[model samples]
Target chain A: MRRTSPISVYLSLLTALLCQLFPWVGQGVILRPDFMLVVILYWLLRSPNLCNVGTAWFAGLLVDLATGSLLGQHALTFSVTAFVALTYQRRLVLFNTWQLLAYVFALLMIERVLILLLKLFEGNENPGFMYFWPVITGLLLWQIMILLFGSLTRPKTN
Target chain B: MLKGVHQKLEPQQSPAFFVRGPSPFSRMVFFCALSVSIMAADARFNYLSQVRQGFIAALHPLEVLANAPSEWTRDTKKYFSEHNRLVQENYALKEQAFEQQIKLQRFNTIEAENTHLRTLLNGNIPIQPKAILGEISHMGRDPFTHTVVVNRGSQHNIKAGQAVVDSKGVIGQVTRVYPFTSEVTLITDKELSIPIQIERNQLRAIAFGEGNNTLDIPYLPTNVDIKVGDKLVTSGIDGVYPSGLAVAIVTKIQQNPESPFAKIVSTPVADVSNHLQLLLLALPDYKEDELSKVAPIETTATKKELSNKNTALIKNKAKANAPH
Candidate 1:
């Protein structure tokens, strides 16, 4: 099994929480990625034995409480993302970095779609294309986190 | 014996290493159910509000930690601002203070005279609302909604349901109050609405947020007497916002021959992007009863037409088409 202490995992999640809580106003709000989700998805994929679906659900609940949207909204999405990540966790050991990035991008897209569907159901007007900016930003954030924490797999040889 | 029982179960469960717990699908099912019920309890009821408040309160330290960098940057920027610019700003502010002092002197007498006239008419005296001055700590994390977290909340006696106004006009309402902060939902958000009157004619209407940065006024007839440049202000009917605060100005009006109602839009007077300081007008003492009373006033054909999401649109169109 890959080496990761539980304390470090929790600490990394806390760092993501702070980024998520950082006050973004005006156009910056549109660009703010799902920091907590990207981080949680990272840990979920890398160390599901330590940080499982329950942890992702709880992290998502914190986001819901923070955003002051419908209380369960983020919780639902985060749990589902965690599940998706877990389903592919075994295969992830063999997959290269590019394949991993693609997988993370797909996970973020699922989250955005979940939120959009929920918002539309709640009678909110459809926000236009700028809505998906967070997914792209999230992928970039995932890369940054990977660099900081070291990758799920070894860096490929030149 | 234990190893034999474990061996019998382990073979069925052992698909791969690290697969010790329940399947991901089962976990997903468990969590999704938990979340759905939580959502139902939250939206359909108020049981979780206190729970929510407690969790947010616990999160307050982390919020401050997150906010610290922005605070430092803002302060350093202020400290390093050019001397010439500071002088210019100070000079301009002094001039404005002098002008405002003159207005204040006149306003004091006008207010006294107005009170005397109101007493004579046996009208209820309107109390000047107490205001809590707050700085915008941060804009909301959600892009789909227009909300801001200010640095004042329940600990400071700031309550939910207060009317927040910036210097230019009404900005929004305080929807959530935490220990150290509150969320103000701007009037241009789709979920918020404010009752307004034409400053020139006092025609009452409700303004709805268009979700974009614009406000829509719906529900007036095709030939309502409103014109461009007409100012919309709070009508005071809702009791949440005090009457007569400037709201917006009619910006666009579309009256189609086929449609029964005219479409109107207005730009809010408040400039949220530029200004950070704002006033959270305390929710009036009598708001609950007043709101209940106003609920049943759909008495006329006009009231039926006023039910559109943007009744403010109609009011704006009328104001735009009217003679000033």
Candidate 2:
């Protein structure tokens, strides 16, 4: 197995941040995926040593700053999501491709729900069902990540 | 012999496999606590504004890069625009300017006469607020808030609380001013409210944003003379917005017998979705001497009296306008 360089991890995370900062107008804003979350989850599951809960927390902080949202809102949700992903990292090796995709989808949903809860607690109006659109888009990005960086599971030696 | 040799080799544990630092639970707990504290401080205090400002300034280069693609496309489209369409637009603009010039001639005399009358009545002169032109850089990132970021910021002498308006009417107010960009919270945001008066009847009321592209005028009586198509203009009593600027037009009114107060809703006149340019009106400056003379409590008392006088004056004007 090739060792993932820490620099590459940080570089990819930065690129994701840039994508998150892109100016999304009209419908694009609603359909925009959580780019930072997808990238962070990918690294956490593939190489826990290189990208851990701390990295996720820091990336969340950057996102919070960039989005101009309440401080630490994303950080808190992201750290919780990272912890959940890390808890199942070992078992993921035993899971097939479909199971791994389900796991990723669950993590994305968890992150979205946590954010919704926090926003509601902050007295914001309920964003409605359209708020969950990002989960579907984030899942698509997850698949893209797998394609670009290779899958987490080891290949069969046929 | 092989079993004995393997036993003698002793259990070899690779440090890399077991060196996962702190457990995930502990890390999660630590980060969660830190974030909660940060969130609390941000929500309840002013310390984080500076941090936010500094970070936004640092991220400005990245924002410009991200915005480059859209800017290029817009420029490209403009470059390919039809020459005939441009000529027609230019002709229309010229005719509009000619009509406005004719109105300006009459407005100049009326304004001068109004100042003279104000001096005769010993009323304080209204201050003309200057404005700075700004372009909308982009819509706000957070979907919960109806805000648009303008390119002008503190560096350009932009300040929080400045009234923003398009050529048509009032748009919003500048809520947060960063180094190079400012966030204008639209009048459609729930957090904002504007003091308005019915242009037809001069009935004064406060309009609160409904958050879904409408304004709600709550607490008004069911019998209040407001009707659909009535225009609402700023009263200027709050001193934030200039007087008589068109705000919203009444669209829907529901009189519920169960509820004492009528449910009045209106849509804003300014359409931000179609335009990119707006003017940020400077805050009206109060002279230091004038401010010192009036106590805060006395000011509030006078403000109440002034509103009462305004309503009474409106009634008299309405009565006079009626045919005997």
Candidate 3:
């Protein structure tokens, strides 16, 4: 297993926050990925000991402050998503690349649905199916994360 | 031999592979409760606005850094624009300004005449609101809320509840003020409503945002004298918006035989997507006094006291202005 430093983990999360702050205009706003969520999930899966549910909760709080939504909305959803990811974390070592990708995809979808329910509960209008566009973009970001910082699975030996 | 065997069979503690501090379930429950309480406090009370303002102020530097790349690109594009296009725009703007100046002269005469007539009739003269120019920093991050962030903020003397407008017409209102930036809730947001009058017939009504980029005027009877092309302008009774600013144009009206109220929807005239510069009009100075008077009649003595104070101030102003 590759060793991950705490500094690198935090630096990457800060970069993700910056990306979230980018001024997306027109259709770009609709398609922008959940950057901080994807990065937090990546670290949570690869090094659960270093980054935990508390980290995810804090990151979600920052997102809430940045987005100027009702406070704690993202925090609630993010902590729940982190818990779900950690529940099956031990079994992940035996999974292959494809299985890992599917797992991450499911995690992303769960987060999206939770946020949708929260928004609906807050009396917002249904944003339609285009709201799910971020899940696809977040999946692509996951692949990029794997490419940059090695995969979660161990290497094969003959 | 039995003693040796027993010693060897003693259990040993081994280091675990995963060293997570807390169980995931417990952590989830803890954070969930924390966040739910936060949401409740934020939604039901006014305690968190100060926290939000301080956080945004601290995050201002990072936001500017994130916006730098886009600003650079726009500047480069502006530098590389064709000179011919600039000249043409300048010429068109100059001609427009000349036409507006002529209209302004006529307006000045009419305004003076109206003020003279109001004074003769002992009516209160309307106040002209001051406005500050602001640029749209970005569309709001939350897609669920129809809002835009403006560059001006509390540091620039921007206050919440100020009306916003563009060159074309009314745009939105300032709902939250940070240190260097403010959030403007667009008129189409479901939470905002504006008092409006039909420009063609002078019939007054309140228009609410439908959350789908349309304004709804509910409770207007089906027999009301409104048309598809009727214009809606600010009524100015609320004191937030100036009177006669264009707001929206009636687009679609649906009526059912069983229902008495008409389903009226209109599209806003000022589109935030089309422009980046807008004006934030200052809140009226007497708004506080007006609100105090409108407060529920808790005590008859206090209500009478407030009315007396208001009349005294008005009389003092009238005496000061009486052609001395």
In DockQ terms, which candidate is top? 3
Tens-digit lDDT track for model 2 on A1-158?
55888987888898899998898999988999999999999999988989889999999999998888889999999999999999989888798888988999899999999999999998789989999999999989988998888999878768
| Local distance difference test, candidate 1 | 0.84
Candidate 3 similarity to native, TM-score: 0.90
lDDT of 3 by residue, B157-245 (tens): 88777789999889988888899999998889888888899999899998988887999999989999999999999998667789999
- Using lDDT as the measure, the top candidate is 3
How far residue A51's Cα lies from its native spot in candidate 1, in Å, is: 1.3
What's the distance in Å from true for residue B172, model 3?
Answer: 0.7
DockQ score of each predicted structure, in the order shown = 0.81, 0.85, 0.90
**TM-score of structure candidate 2:** 0.89
lDDT by residue for model 2 over B258-285, one digit each (tens)? 9989999999999999989999998776
**In model 3, where do residues sit more than 4 Å from their true spots?**
B1-17, B288-324
Model 3: per-residue Cα lDDT over A1-158, one tens digit each: 77999998999998999999999988988999999999999999999988899999999999999999999999999999999999888898899999988999999999999999999998888899999999999999999998988888878879
Better of 2 and 3 by DockQ: 3
Q: Is candidate 1 or candidate 2 better by lDDT?
A: 2
Q: What is the TM-score of chain A alone in each candidate?
A: 0.94, 0.97, 0.98
Q: Higher-TM-score candidate among 2 and 3?
A: 3
